[model samples]
Target: MNQIIIFDFDGTLADTLDAVVRITNRLSGEFGYLPTNPETLSQIQNLSSWQIIQQSGISLFKLPFLLKRVISELNQDLQLIHLFPTIPEIIQQLQKKNYTLYIITSNSKINVITILSRYNLVNSFKNVYSGISLFGKHKIINQLLNQENIEPQQVIYIGDETRDINAAKQAKIKSIAVSWGYNSAEILLQHHPDALIAHPSELIAVIEQIKNPIG
Candidate 1:
């Protein structure tokens, strides 16, 4: 069976921190949360998503509604979003190597497709699963594993957040945390993912190492 690589979209593939921070601040007033400033934004990178949520004072009960609104708002400016430098080539190289790639994200399917299409990456992935709950990625990951009849050891989840690492752990799969996203390298290291990659091209070596460990 072909090995599967599950990816988180927002920070892992797309450089969405600027867009997300802008959108969140714009919607903060109506959502009844404190807005983040440039300094606060830097601090947020040091914290996990859940920790940032707690600091923002946003009610947990209001997340689904807020998430829906954020997605709708972000979709309007799909042109403003972009993938990180070298990400497209990295993805293409991985696909060329016959790896089965999949993306699981909390963003809307429409938005993800729009961005992927913009970068000519729409067909690179075997599947793109979106609209995942903020804290429910583990469930989605587990479902994919069972649906594909793939073993946890045969899969690796690459993401840029602490929650992603935790979810991968819960699903019993290896986690590769990337630093060029919402979470800083220091914060990601604290989460203790199986591998920590700082550049897009490094992914190739990491995957190879996982598939064939030094013995």
Candidate 2:
């Protein structure tokens, strides 16, 4: 059975949470957004991205600029970003099982490719769709499906945020929310992803279940 697994790069594939927090905090003063304290971090992890943007006092107009700066800062710190535990092995296993993989991300393509190249995992994904709009990932997912000639039913978009789940839904595909990423389990559960996985190792089992829903 051939399947396509599209992934969100930042929190889903690479553990860039701490670095993002640091960058956002460092720029908070300049951007007029509230800096994330420990409490604020916990609070926002459970909130959707839009909610966070609202609470942080950042206008939608400034989000793109802010994100661009953040991504640029993140680029400078790419050496600090890395795959979550067991991701390499999981990717290998999925490849062995013949799952075609790709990445769709708001992060820059260079950033995604640089990290994959670091781990010698560049060949794992057939292609990458990067630098997507912060709120327009559904369009990218649809484009990827059309470009790849894959049906929504045969594809699953996996990510760590409620927006990702929403995008997958908007694109008419299944979503598996990962708890080990940006969103908390409780928050992700509320989004009602088709499957919610807690660890990288749990991915294979969930994919298998998606492949065979009755079994």
Candidate 3:
């Protein structure tokens, strides 16, 4: 069977936590809420803006305005987006192996495209799926499975958070959780992903193992 590999953009392919923290805290200040510290912000890195607000005790009445403002600001700050270390090499290796690659992200389409283009990695992916709504990984994954004619057993989803693992499970695809992203090893391990990778290089070995597993 042919293999397809899908990746989550923000925390998995790019180091976006710094940008997320900056934007979240800026929005919190704008909404008259206490600014979140880096440590606190790190813990909620996997959540969407609405989810973060709810988890952080922000009132529902202020959420809509705050979310809109934050998203607008983030869109304007695209210059700050960056690819994670060694990601280009990883993409090159996967391409060399003839692995079908795609990106399934919660980020808006424009932002995902712009960032990938900026990093010159846009051509590495055969397709990019961006979710219109927050926390839309599951929906995107389902779409890819049906629209792209990819079977669950022939695909692997690589991501940073427990939510990504759950999304892959919901889509019936194998999942690999990366420890170097937003969520720690402990949090990702709780989801019991098919594998866990600590560095970009380890991903190649994981994919090889998946392609040739022992009975």
Give the winner by TM-score: 2
**Per-residue error at 207 for model 3, in Å?**
1.4
lDDT of 2 by residue, 81-176 (tens): 999888988888889999999999999999999999978888999999976487899999988989989999999889999999999999999999
Query: Model 1: what TM-score?
Result: 0.97
Q: Which candidate number would show the highest lDDT if scored against the true structure?
A: 2
- The TM-score between candidate 2 and the true structure equals 0.97
lDDT (Cα, 0-100) at 9 in candidate 1: 96
lDDT of 1 by residue, 63-162 (tens): 7888888888888878889999999999999999999999999998888989999888999998887754888999988877888788988898999999
Candidate 3: tens digits of C-alpha lDDT, residues 1-215: 77899999888998777786788777775676777786676666555434565777777677656656655666887888888878988898899889999998766667777888876888989899876444567888989889989888989999988788888888888999998877778777877899998998899999889778989
Whole-model Cα lDDT of every candidate shown, in order: 0.90, 0.90, 0.81
Error of 2 at 23 (Å): 0.7
The residue pairs found clashing in candidate 3 are none
Which candidate, 2 or 3, has the higher TM-score? Answer: 2
**TM-score for each predicted model, relative to the true structure:** 0.97, 0.97, 0.87
User: Comparing candidate 1 with candidate 2, which one achieves the higher TM-score?
Assistant: 2
